[model samples]
Target: MMMHRQYLIDQAIIARNILRVALPLQRLRASATRPTLPETPTRFAIIAGDVTDPSSSLGDLAMFSALMQSLRAQNPDSIFTIIGERRHTIVVPGIGETPVEPAWAGKTGTLAFDELIRQHHALFVMGADILDGKYGAALVQRIVAYCNHSVLLGIPATMLGFSFNRNPRAPAVHALSRLHPHVTVNIRDQPSLDRFTRIVGVLAQLCADSAFLMPSATDPITEPEAWIASMRQEGRTPVGINLNAHALAPAIAEVGMDQLIDHFAEQFKRAGEQNGLAFMLLPHDLKSQSGDVSMLQALDQALQRKGFTHVRYASIDQPDKIKRLIGLLDLAITGRMHLVIASLGSGTPTLSITYQDKFEGLYQHFELSLEHTITPMQCLTDELLRKINDAFMHRHDNRARILSHLPRVKALASQNLAIATCGHTD
Candidate 1:
């Protein structure tokens, strides 16, 4: 009881401080502009708590970055107020570098009660995973607090490029349903949009996953160093492999980790022997304890245990560089969403071992067959090798199909930005 009361008191103080600083910050922003301008436009952005994250943010930051580019192109007058403990530089696809900082760790200072948030035009809440209001989730508290407060204040709040794991009851249909015309929600897949509109009674606009619209990553262009030139020259088809350690380890804990690693290695070895292909391990994250970089090592050790040592591993933290490497492959075998996004975005053929709805959902969005997907439960069976062989054999045709579908998908993603900024989809 005391803890809950203290929480409310802290919130009250924070809100009061923000309210107190609102007018001065408004005055400061008002002073910066031209006399011909009518009013200063600002946006309140609520990103996931880990704004500095690379892998866990998944490919959502790439989409958010693309959205930032669109906002800069269309709504030049807009400034942003981001909410997080820490902020860092993220390469915004085509727009180069943008700092995603609205607050620093443990310090409110002058920007503490952000004027843009207090007297804001719109609120944007997004992340790869947080937008899914699942139970026992931490970030949804921020969304609930911010959106509810903003809606009550008559500020337009938008949930941008997110998915819902389940219909939220704690912050369910009430606040959003009541906000009516002021709130806007854009989802990346038809499945998510259908669920939101059908079960939750909130209207959700369909947009291609924002990752599809991110500008060609500079990682491949900027890095210049070849992470895998020797292997590329070997005259055999190269396959890019990304295993999602975070999801796979926890979800498949019932299966021993060593056995799981051996299963993948054995399959890869079989695929190599059958198809005359070389494999390259690509790491998508470096900072996290359980990120792709560390996990790649574990898989490598496992492969060594089985006397397989010829497989090459590539360590890269830049999303763009990862995309470039994925493009070099004849086929991508991945459990991670961003790896799949980078592979297919560049029209690199892919076969995914999916653990979440996001993968199957996005693949469905592209009208691609999910026959190539295998679950962890199906990993011990022969289905893994079958999909691997089939996907590689028909990779060129799949690449062409992906390329054919891309322009249309990119345009729809752009329409999502248009609707958010200009209130029109076309």
Candidate 2:
């Protein structure tokens, strides 16, 4: 009987060891044939935000693209189990199999969390726009989930480069302090880094947004869209313009959003009449309910109503494709964060339409001149015309400046990914 009990204990310990190393094979759903691995395979979990959403911001796409590139490069042949909804699939270059269909998908939201603990080696909590503090409670909940699954369940959890910027901030910080002790927090901007360092003992390592790390995709839209063809036929230089939906929301704005839109239309109409400055009114995102397409259509109609026939709308969703499209432009004036990244990354002279501190941080990273960044509130004035014309006038020099800083920004972006995936213990 004692010998039998000893054998049972031995069995329990063996089971525990395996659970610590590999998630039970039965949990992971089978997919198309996978690449061969050694006797043992290492698996990492990437838990980012709702990147699959068609209307999702290009910034989110940019972040995910950079992350996957660096992670896959650093850990080739390692199994990647993406933790999120499995609705839409993003085709990352060189990935043979779908990174979805993980062991945890149906189990956590649909299946069970206890089932996931059985598979926990480590998890990367890659949030989307967490620093905006709009998702403070959501991020806190994620932190709690990570702590429960990792610390309590004996798995390592790491928080990648995210932001922490919220006003009336002190009361909101208690929850942030509750983040898993083992989790490494990598801040994306100097403001976030400074705030955390001063407020919390844990001064986060400052890193650039992952978007800067992404490579320009070779495949562009070969042909399509009547407006594009029409614009090309005009034989004038095509400049790209992107406006965010939220920035133009009537209810949200203190000023008359409609009037502002009209004013913008008039200014562009004036520019077009003066210099044949035609516009490719490109929408950066289409995922949100009031996404870029809605905003673009609204602005397009307003411009058309005012007799600005030179403005043509083009909606490109994929970041790579968008980058390629933006490259075709002589100049790009955009409010979309990733659009700006796309333009600058492609060595295209771009004007950044700033919405908040995020744009400031981004332009600062490349030491871009402040004159190039303008707020929507300021977009109604002569200042807008000056900035727009300046971009077109000094387009060549600006492109050179962007290219000069591209190497450094790329290095910082790569470093952000490195620290994020390194699983820092301290």
Top-scoring candidate (TM-score): 1
lDDT of 2 by residue, 394-414 (tens): 888887888898887777666
Candidate 1: tens digits of C-alpha lDDT, residues 133-224: 44222334345445544443445566666665554443333334533444567787787778767766766688776667665655444332
TM-score of 2: 0.76
Per-candidate TM equals: 0.78, 0.76
* Cα-based lDDT at residue 276, candidate 2: 70
- Clashing pairs in model 2? 55-286, 55-287, 56-287, 106-111, 107-111, 107-112, 131-163
Cα lDDT listed for each candidate: 0.62, 0.61
Positional deviation of residue 348's Cα in model 1 after best superposition, in angstroms = 1.4
The local distance difference test score of model 2 is: 0.61
* Cα misplacement distance, residue 333 of candidate 1 (Å): 1.4
On lDDT, the candidate that comes out on top is 1
